[model samples]
Target: MSMQTPKQLGGISFGLMDPETYRDMSATKVITADTYDDDGYPIDMGLMDPRLGVIDPGLECKTCGQHSGSCNGHFGHIELAAPVIHVGFTKLIRRLLRSTCRECGRLALTEYEREEFRERLQRAKDLGEDPNDVLKSAVRQARKASNCPHCGEQQADIKHEKPTTYYEVQDVLSGEYSEQIAAAMQPDEDDPDDEGTSPSELASQSGIPLDRINEIVAGEFRPRTEDRKALESALDIDLTEEDMNKLMASDIRDWFEDIPDDDLGVLGIDGEISRPEWMVMTVLPVPPVTAVRRSPSITAA
Candidate 1:
């Protein structure tokens, strides 16, 4: 029994449940929806497993060996057939997803900017100054960049549907960049500005480099290798040209599955936050046996 009133009681904090926490609290492995047998007895190993505790008076709880009202209801869990996004953290998820690059899965902030922000944060810590405002401002600035500096991929505007679903404005490769590549591939001799002079023809004709022209001609687009390598290490994948090609065709949902643990921690996830794609309802804690016991239905005379 708690001494504090409902208003004074500190509520439980909801967070991702690690396996250890889940298993320690669970009283029985619930497999079926049926709670009781034909005789109205709690079916063993069912949703109302006796191991969860005796819900009736005069019957001792199998777990705590206490009768109803004396024993608190034990915890039992339901393994979801599929994961659903946690409703509470929807905003956090949306912000983090938008702020991170889809291609490299890194924060939008460039390396130099990241270092500068980190140094400021460190200085603040050393000086015993509250860094909340500084950190917020830094994160805000980082999230404003429309393009990922590392991958050179323009970020799409994220639109979140009420409750759970999220969508983004995806760009077709053939739309904007294709025109630029086409412009780059146009011959210098063909350009009206080029006089076919004795001077530096290449420099005068087009400011774009020869290698860049070759890339356009070859129809080869390489993502920033530096960030790709870092992402590969985080995802534990080789990410060869072939892999990247395959990924280019896949949906963004697939990409979310490989986000690293460190990134999740930065997003305020504490422990073992694997695969941001689905929010797993891993553990379900049952109330005390006393809490589960229901009063008899009163019939009108």
Candidate 2:
């Protein structure tokens, strides 16, 4: 056979793989954490499923039908019970969340500003120059808008707690209520009839689970007027129109999905190879056993 060598090397681009692409390339789905069976054979649908590739010398690869030494191996995938944020991309995700409208998923900028940014990004790309500075400027401007220019919905400040947790600062008690609540919460030893609200009660009300908040936001759960009144009376404070809510991986993914392809360039993303939603992982790829296992000689050493 004759071989041809290339004179010039083209550039390489890296991108995240979406779930569809992951499943398409996978040889099997790994369900169990267990690797082998009681009889010392690889288990089907398990982490060490033979379909993922052969690590043992005598065994043939189920996917490629080749012996261990000759088989290059294949990939397997695991479907996560819930979507999870990729730790590496948490900062980028936070930037995207702050710069885009939560409801309309468009850049939180005026029409003129959006057009201006798109042009700058496209010009930079055409010159083969880095567009990071332009992207940062757009994010900075978008973050300043209190309401979405496209949808007119109020935008809340998104705060990231260490690692992966994100919280939306929806609303706060007004100055008047803050002062009243502070006074009401104080205990007066001289007046035995005075009862101060416990801290635990306040914590419970404020720390509503993200899932329940999602339901409430979707109009799936509605509190009766009486219940609302009762809660206000018990707390000795009026609840704000919107309560602070946590953002889950799924919620973040949904927000990203609403972003249009045309806007991705301004967000420092290439829409052709990567979508923003893919940053939150729904499926994980597992390398073949041969690629991970240590040889007997290396293990002994």
Candidate 3:
């Protein structure tokens, strides 16, 4: 009978749901197995996650211009099974995305699924079931996959920024493009004909321009952003500044991205892919009290 403020729901003192609990308690429903596709196939792929309310209908959202983030739905439906997930409390249907098509349109969650999931979630709560497992399942299923709908460029939603010297640089260079970029930045012209090499490969090999191959093949490396135009001419390959920026924008800086799931080496970059620095820093009596780097592996190691 007493009203509790939304602000008082959680802080340092009490860890609880938002003060809008009564509002959220409205009936939420889960997508039943009966849900079907245009072909009469189960839209859920038979692997139903209770947490996921609906699958994303992979289509372009005309309103938002991009299909990745929240938007007021307004778009022509593409004949696609757009799987989506609905958050219980808010009944927010987040689209489950893969690689988005920049040329076509963005992803969108179905409103129908949102309402359905909310009802099911309310019922689950009333039954005194824990919401933790459902929440976790939802997280894994709902991976963030977004891109620029206009330029057809990949979205830089998740950034992998790193700072370091030797090993770290080498690690970053382990990616397919990273190695190509490193090789391109400093080309070896005197090494005779690079049989399968292309202007693009050359662009990646020396981190310079394919057009500037001759010049860069004999010159020092420059900053990634600046001096690209000059370098392009040196390579004599007609490489553009936009090309360099696209490569730079990619997750080429992440070595772990390319690393395979094994305890051993990846393609020849030998070593147990863990923190070698831990033993390096901790073992020495007067350990180097330098700035510590926090990578996913470092902390886990």
Worst 10 contiguous positions by lDDT, candidate 3: 280-289
lDDT over C-alpha atoms for residue 254 of model 3: 32
Please, what is the whole-model Cα lDDT of each candidate in the order they appear? 0.57, 0.79, 0.30
How many Å off is the CA of 119 in candidate 2?
2.1
Per-residue C-alpha lDDT of model 3 across residues 218-280, encoded as one tens digit per residue = 443333433444443444433332211122211221322332222111111123433111111
For all predicted structures, in order, the TM-scores are 0.56, 0.74, 0.22
Off by over 4 Å in 2: 1-9, 126-129, 174-243, 295-301
lDDT for each residue of candidate 1 in 82-103, tens digit (9 for 90 to 100): 5546677677667766777877
Summarize candidate 2's per-residue lDDT along 191-254 as a digit string, tens digits.
8986765445533564544454344334455534453344356566674555568999999999
Q: Total clashing residue pairs per candidate?
A: 6, 0, 35
Ranking the candidates on lDDT from highest down gives 2, 1, 3
Superior by TM-score: candidate 1 or candidate 3 = 1
Best by lDDT: 2
Model 3 ranges off by over 4 Å: 1-113, 147-196, 200-301
